[model samples]
Target: MDVTTIIGLFVGILSLVVGFLIEGGTLGSLLQETAAIIVFGGTIGAVIISFPLKTLKKVPFIIKYAFTASSSHSMTTVENMVELSNVSRRQGLLALETQQDMYEDDPFLSEGIRMIVDGVEGETIKDILNREIELYERRMLSIGKVFETAGGFAPTMGIIGTVMGLVHVLGSLDNPSALGPAIAVAFIATLYGVASANVIYLPIFNKIKARLDDDLMIKELQAEGLISIQYGENSTLLRNKLMAFIDDEVKSESEQVEDVNVNA
Candidate 1:
């Protein structure tokens, strides 16, 4: 589903195969099940030992995220804030009480709405929202670090597999033909390690980081818009402020609407 992830995998494998072919190697030479088992098994075992069960369970989700574009809630946040601003202007801050269920479903929106509904001052709301954002960012970064660690260790495990293969080759050195196969097996570990690290693990880590950044940006916009609403700013002013989070085309459209209304 993630084109980038798919492309990255395809490119990495293609490059590896091309490089191998250029070096007078064939696919048959690299087909080593024992090497694969060693690299994959050892790396996974080490990862399990390093991380908690709950954290480990999140690996697949993290992998999925790596390939998929982030689900940006900026537009949703802006829409909700615009509605809340209208409600506040029409019926005072207490009017938002009935909409609490909708707000509660979205934690970022819910927290900001709660701050305003609770009569928190704008500055205090900013502080509270910022603190929450920081906490979430830290948690997200920690999750990214887990995949990074996996990427780092995968190659090392591959080397370990290579060493094991070399050991077998050394024992069979008396047979030259056997040495070639053994060496091939040993090198396959390195290939798996490099492929997994470059193609999968590292890319996932970067994707999570990017997604976290986008999520944080959306939360920040929500926080700022909520604070502006809490201070009884005009809907036009609040809308203008929130529009900064959107693209130039959207901003232009919004401004055009304002221009038309002014003429009317």
Candidate 2:
């Protein structure tokens, strides 16, 4: 599990509760079953209506992965790519088949190696890998859109719930003393709607987008590295080229060390 996602979500919820308490609000006042059902149920119904069942079926997996830790293994990938480049340069392209097991966990790298081992043209390899990246991103973005749709509908559902509550308040005007509390209870649906949209749904959507970018960068790097190996590029040159994909700070420090070695 990704602890940051858990921590961020916890902190967000706690902030709301703490802020409410600071404002002299009672916790019991926030626990309205009617408001919850109205806001959450309506929001869910809206999302279901907006998307197909096949798309909705992926929500559980999408939500699970949003909280899951994803590893880029960028440096390890570069190292393996460099090693494969050297192996191919010295022995032959067929030698990469023996090293394929090392990349079994990374389907992108493993598949790229397999294609090259089978003598797939470098251009063809690049095209196939790029196409896979495009399709994968499309699917992930579609899943992220589910949360986006929910976030968009939640506020409106809240307003609907609040209005329904207010209509009830209007019917109970005989008990004027209860008006203030009743109005407050009616607004709780609005709170649930707004809070869930901003704190939960939208944030998860953005998290999935951010993860997509990270995963794409790693995949692109693998694609480039694999293509270079297929073309029998020099291992040193390929390493230098791939190192550019690392973070700027790491790349700068590595360059400085290289300069010192050259001067020595």
Candidate 3:
């Protein structure tokens, strides 16, 4: 689980509630069942109309992905590539076929290696893997779009709810004493809409996109590694080449400081 995501959600809710309390707002004033029903129900109806049923089925997975921290495999991928390079250099490309089991968990890596062992051309390997990556990206992004769609529709739904509430308020104008409370209840729809959009839907969409980018980078790294292995690149040189895929922040801070000291 992602602790930061949990912490951020908690902080956002706590701040809102505490700030409201400080401003002399009651919790009861915020708890309007009618407003919630209108905003959320309308938003859901909009989302359902916007996306297909198949795509909507993945909401649970999308939410789980947003809350979960993705594991970094850059270093492991680099090391594995270097190992494969060494094996191919010593025993020829055909030897990699026997080692396919080692990468079974990663079909992308395994398939690339299999193609290499099958004597696929370097350009063809790159083309096939790149196309696969593109398709994977498109598919994942379409799923994340559910959140994006919801975020967009929520505010509009809130406004609609507020308008509907105001219409009712106008209808009951003779009850002057009830006007302020009616207006307050009507505006709760707007609050729910805006808050849910900002704090939940939109953030989850961005988080899913961030995770997707990470997964794509790993796939690209593996593809590069498999191609390098097929071409009989030196393990040391391949390792250095693959190291470029790792983020600078992920590299050791001590090593960078030591390099500066050595230069000094």
Candidate 4:
């Protein structure tokens, strides 16, 4: 589980409640079941209409993954790519075929190595890998757009709910004593819509987009490593190239390990 995401959501909710209480509001004031149903139900319906059914089907997965850690293996990827370069330098491109299991878990890495072992030209390999990256990005953006659409519709839905409530309240304005409570109830729908959109839908949309960035960076690194190996670049040059994608602290640690291994 992603601790930061969980904590962030909890803090957002708590802060809202605390601020409401500080302003002389009661928790009961925010608990309008009819208003909630109107806001959320309408928002969901509008989102379903905005996107294709197949795309909406991915909403649960998108929400789950937004709070989940990415599966990139960045440091391990650098190590693996550097190792492949060393192996190719010592042997030849055909030698990569015997070590297929090293990249078996990642299709992008696996396919790149497969193409290299099959003697595909460097330019062709780069083209195919770049295309794969582009398609992957488009797919992720489509998913993120679902949440984006939801965020856009929520506040509007809130206003719609409030208007409906006011219609009913005005129709029954014969009792002046009930007017204050009725007006308060009428605005609850708007509060539900605005709050859920800002705190939930918008945040989830941004989170998913950020995850896509990390994923793209990892894939780009794999593509670079594969093309460099095809060129039969030496391990030292390959390591430096991949290190550009890593953190400075991690680079220092990797260099220290390499020095220790060489000295021993």
Candidate 5:
């Protein structure tokens, strides 16, 4: 779980609720089916119209990622790359075939190994990997745009809901008691719109952006690992290079262990 995502969401909601309570507002004041229909329904409708079906299917996964850390194995990936580099240097690139099973589950590792096995040139491999990364980035951005659009539209829809309620109240202005309830309802839409946009849609957009950045970093690590392996760098040297991507504490521990082993 991502602490930042959880804390951010919790704090946003708590602040809103506390502010409303301080203003003597009840929870029921913000509940309006008409407002919900306008904001949520319209937003969904617009999103469906804007994005492809394939992209829409990724919404659930995107939501999950909002609260979860990325699945990239930073330190483990570096270790694997170092191992592959060693193997390639000792027994030629073809030797990687024997260890394919070890990295089979990792698409980035598998792809690099497969390309080497197929005798593809380094430039060709880099081009192919870059293309794949670009495609993935585009798809993620498309998904992120959906949330961004929702954030943008929800407030507008709220205003529409408010105007609609005001029109109803204006028609019955002679009934002062009815007018009060109608005015309250009208304002509810605006509240809901602001709350949803800030707490839900905008946060989702930010989370998606963060996830995309992590993914880009993971891909960069993979690319560097593959290139190091192809160049047949010494395993220890390659490992040190990869360790640069890890946190300082972890890198220190691993370096100390390596130093001890070398001395032994």
Candidate 6:
């Protein structure tokens, strides 16, 4: 589980509720089942209509991704690639086939190594893996777009709910005493919509985009690492080349300070 995501969520909710309590607001004043049903139901209906049912079905899995560790394997994968490069240099490329079990933790890296061991041409390997990368990117984007669509629809749905509530209030103008609370309840849907969009849906969409970018970089690095090994690039050079893809991640704080000083 991702502690950062959990902590961030807890912090966001706690801040809002604590501040609300400090302002003399009770939880009961904000708890409106009708407003929740209207905002969430309308938003979900709009999202389902916006996207295909098949893609919507994957929402739970994609949302879970936000609360989980990133799937980026660039760091470990570079090490593995360097080891494979050494093996190819000392023994031979074909010797990699015997070491398949060693890379069971990462199937994509293992598959790339298998291609190199099978003596696949550099161009052919690049073409196949590039296609794989493109397909993977499209799939991830589809999932991200689901949350994107929900975020887009949520605020609009909230406004619609408010309008519906106001229409009812206008129809019952005889109950002037109920008007104040009715107006407050009418805007709760808007609050729910805006809060859900900013706090949940949009955040998840952006998180998926960032994670997918990292994942694709790892895949691209694997493709290049495998191809370089197949072409018999020097092991040290190949390791350096792969590590370059993740420069920001590998840079130490001291190196970052030096960079800041240099830029200054």
Which candidate wins on lDDT? Answer: 2
Positional deviation of residue 183's Cα in model 2 after best superposition, in angstroms: 0.4
| Tens-digit lDDT track of model 1 for 40-139 | 8787788888878877777677667666776556666777788888999999998787777875657877877776788888999899899999998986
Where's the lowest-lDDT run of ten residues in candidate 2?
A: 71-80
Model 5: per-residue Cα lDDT over 61-110, one tens digit each = 88887778876667767766777787888789999898888767777768
Model 4 stretches astray by more than 4 angstroms: 247-264
**Weakest ten-residue segment in model 4 by summed lDDT:** 71-80
Which stretches in model 1 have alpha-carbon errors above 4 Å? 18-25, 73-76, 245-264
* Reference-based lDDT, each prediction: 0.81, 0.92, 0.88, 0.88, 0.82, 0.85
Residue by residue across 1-264, what tens digits does model 4's lDDT show? 667778877898899999999999999998999998888999888988888989888878888888998876667787788888888888888899887876688889899999999999999999999999999999988988988888889999899989998898889879989888898998988888888888888988888888888888889888999999999887888878888888788778877988999999
Model 4, clash count? Answer: 0
Highest TM-score model number: 2
Candidate 6 yields a Cα-based lDDT of: 0.85
Scored by lDDT, model 3 comes in at 0.88
Query: Over the stretch 113-182, how does candidate 6's per-residue lDDT look in tens digits?
Result: 8888788899999899999999999998998898888888889988988898999899999999999989
Q: Candidate 2 vs candidate 5: which has greater lDDT?
A: 2
Kindly report which residue stretches of model 6 are placed more than 4 angstroms away from their true locations once superposed: 71-73, 253-264
Candidate 3 structure quality by residue, lDDT tens digits, 88-189: 999999999988998788788889988998899998999999999999999889989999999999998999999999999999999999999999889989
Q: Count the backbone clashes (under 3 Å) in each candidate.
A: 0, 0, 0, 0, 0, 0
Better of 4 and 6 by lDDT: 4
Model 3 lDDT, residue 35, Cα:
89
TM-score of each: 0.82, 0.93, 0.92, 0.91, 0.87, 0.91
